[model samples]
Target: MRLLHTMLRVGDLDRSIAFYTDILGMKLLRRQDYPEGRFTLAFVGYQPESEGAVLELTHNWDTASYELGNGYGHIALGVPDAYAACEAIRAAGGKVVREAGPMKHGTTVIAFVDDPDGYKIELIQRD
Candidate 1:
């Protein structure tokens, strides 16, 4: 079976959406509000959800922040050029926690950017 989506709890839905769509060049696949649960879910991805796995951003009406415990690792995205991708992300007002370069102990180039909710997203250069 194929993977569906990865869920992340975001404090600011609009900001998070902007980071993913505007900065990361992803599209908002779907969005829905749960009035009864006082929360909202927005799915986004590089392609149609039917064909690609997506990210689900969950915004709880009451939560303004999260701890981002150690249990969660960063999400990875394949890029034609990690350096170019990182530069674009920076130009788009995205913060690059790590500059694009050859990975430690390896040759694969990589970079990192953080989401509004503090989730780490890794950009890996594809050969």
Candidate 2:
């Protein structure tokens, strides 16, 4: 079976959506509010959900933040140029936790940016 979307709990739904859509160049696929559960779910991606996996942003009405435990790693995105991606992310008001450079002990270039909710996104240079 194909993989689906990855879910992340965000403190502010609008801010998180702006980071993914405005900074990361992703589209807001869909969003729905669960009134009974006091939460909202918004989906975003580079393509249609049927074409590839997407991201699910969950906002709980009563929760302002979450502790990102050590178990959660960053989400990776393939880019034509890790350096350019880092620059663009920074220009778009994103936080670059790591500059673009060859991965430690490897030749592959990589960089990192943090979302509004402090979720890490890895940019990997691809041919």
Query: Highest lDDT, which number?
Result: 2
Off by over 4 Å in 2: none
- TM-score of model 2 (CA atoms): 0.98
Tens-digit lDDT track of model 1 for 11-105: 99999999999999999988999999999999999998889799999999999989999899999999999989988999999999999999899
In angstroms, give how far residue 83 of model 2 lies from its true place: 0.8
Worst 10 residues of 2 by lDDT: 116-125
Which whole-number lDDT from 0 to 100 does residue 45 have in model 1? 97
Query: Each model's TM-score?
Result: 0.98, 0.98
Candidate 1: misplaced stretches above 4 Å?
none
lDDT of 2: 0.96
C-alpha RMSD of each candidate structure in angstroms = 0.7, 0.6
The lDDT per prediction is 0.94, 0.96
Per residue, candidate 2 scores C-alpha lDDT tens digits across 36-62 of 999999999999999999999999999
